[model samples]
Target: INCSFQNSVEFSQQVFVHTSGSPSFSSDELEIVEGSILGKHYKVEAFLGEGGFGIVAKCRDTTTNRAVAIKVNKSDPDILQQAHVEIFILEQLRRLDPDAANIVQWNGFFHDGERVCLKFELLDQCLWDYIRDRNKQGLPISEVRPILGQLTNALSHLSSVGIVHADLKPANIMVVNRHESPIKVKLIDFGLACPASAVMPGEFVGTVGYCAPEVMLGLPYNEASDMWSLGLVAVELATGVPLYPSENDYDYLKFIIETQGQPPDHVLDSGVYTEDYFIGD
Candidate 1:
């Protein structure tokens, strides 16, 4: 479903891939509202959500007469730099079949004024919203099973391509269509994704409760960390409550130790940050 909009959505003067000229703007200046146009092609219909990166707008591709989600990056320097990194990670992911990989279909990128806009297929709702919509009751095992399968399949593809999805959580997972039978989901938000070889120990990433123990421990990690987050997400899907429900790494480790017992001495000793949690050497 990758549509080539090159003939349609023209790129603005600025592009994230090249040209690092300093750009400045206040949040108000980049605000997008209903009826606004992006890249002179996407007609803003409604806002899906917003984040530190910027905003995701549910826009109508006036050229193709189709719906799409356009994530526009903020003009802040650091945020813009991160957006460039995201594009780098996404470019590596482009080789995989979006459907088979169970990942979001990226429709390439374009410069929307000074913002880096990423185009993606329109999705129904995120797992967080979906769970909340069900009154926090969670979903049946039958539903959860398939959803988990798709996510693992996505992780598999990511691994094959040597990418680590540093951030995997309910909010980053989107359901294609809630009303559709045999619900399908795709992993979204790769802003934290990076090459496995580039992993640096002691660098913390991922959502609080969903973060893997290795990541929290400041140990070298890979796809295994993503698997850990997936396990938490699956539990949340089935119970309507976070399995860890911990606010900080300390509480997170405490809960894990309580239920699963502390990690073996060797594992704990290997973590760069392990000393922070230990009372005795």
Candidate 2:
């Protein structure tokens, strides 16, 4: 896989697969079924959700009978290439951290003619949904502390290793309460995450409310970007409300800036930032 970030969208059109021995086949020669069960490989249980990227479905791995979440990329070449890059990055990160409690396990990846599929461990609920439901019951802060602690530890570990999870919102965090010696907050979805040390050429990449100020300004970014997102998560956990409440991207960013202020000097010192970004009105 090409690790270097070129214009992935342009290069994706040239993607071809070949077999060295006996016979060779090109990706163009293969076919795919849209909105159909993949069959044999995975049994589709239910639809999970849909996003601009593609559809996610809860599936049972037929061979192992294990439940997994399958994310199917859009048919567009650019989207498909972006998904491939995401899967590759996830595979590398999983190799670095194999502990099931820390991150989502990537079962496998495959291409279905028109799209790429990523198989991830399926969790019952996302952190955001869990908090919303718990809030309806008016769960005490004390009850939620333990869950928050575990997540903080995960963030600490990732940050220590120089990995900044660009998208650290409630939805990206998964809640797994199996046999709770300690509640687990498995960090899932690396589709928006990038290496903390790498300099991103673009200004936009992450979710609106969760995006760091530096990221929105089209500047470089580092670990502090993740911290900013974490701060938003902390606010949500503490109040059961989003720190920046806005209906759209522009409004969301405005809300954050007006309240959170600009990124602190310590954040800018990380060398992945600029002052041009604003969070909210």
**Best lDDT goes to which candidate?**
1
Q: What 10-residue stretch in candidate 1 is worst by lDDT?
A: 13-22
- By TM-score, the best candidate is 1
Quote the lDDT for 25 in model 1: 36
lDDT of 1 by residue, 1-281 (tens): 12233533222223322221123433355677789999988999988877667788899999889999998997777776677677777878888999999999998888887788999999999999999988999899989999999999999999999999988999999999999989999999988777787777777878778888888888899988999999999999998889999767798888988899888889989998988987662
Candidate 2 lDDT, 134-237, residue by residue in tens: 76343356656766676677667666556666778888888766335455778887776555655453446677777776666556778778778887787787
lDDT for model 1 comes to 0.83
Model 2 segments beyond 4 Å from truth? 1-36, 98-101, 136-139, 178-182, 260-281
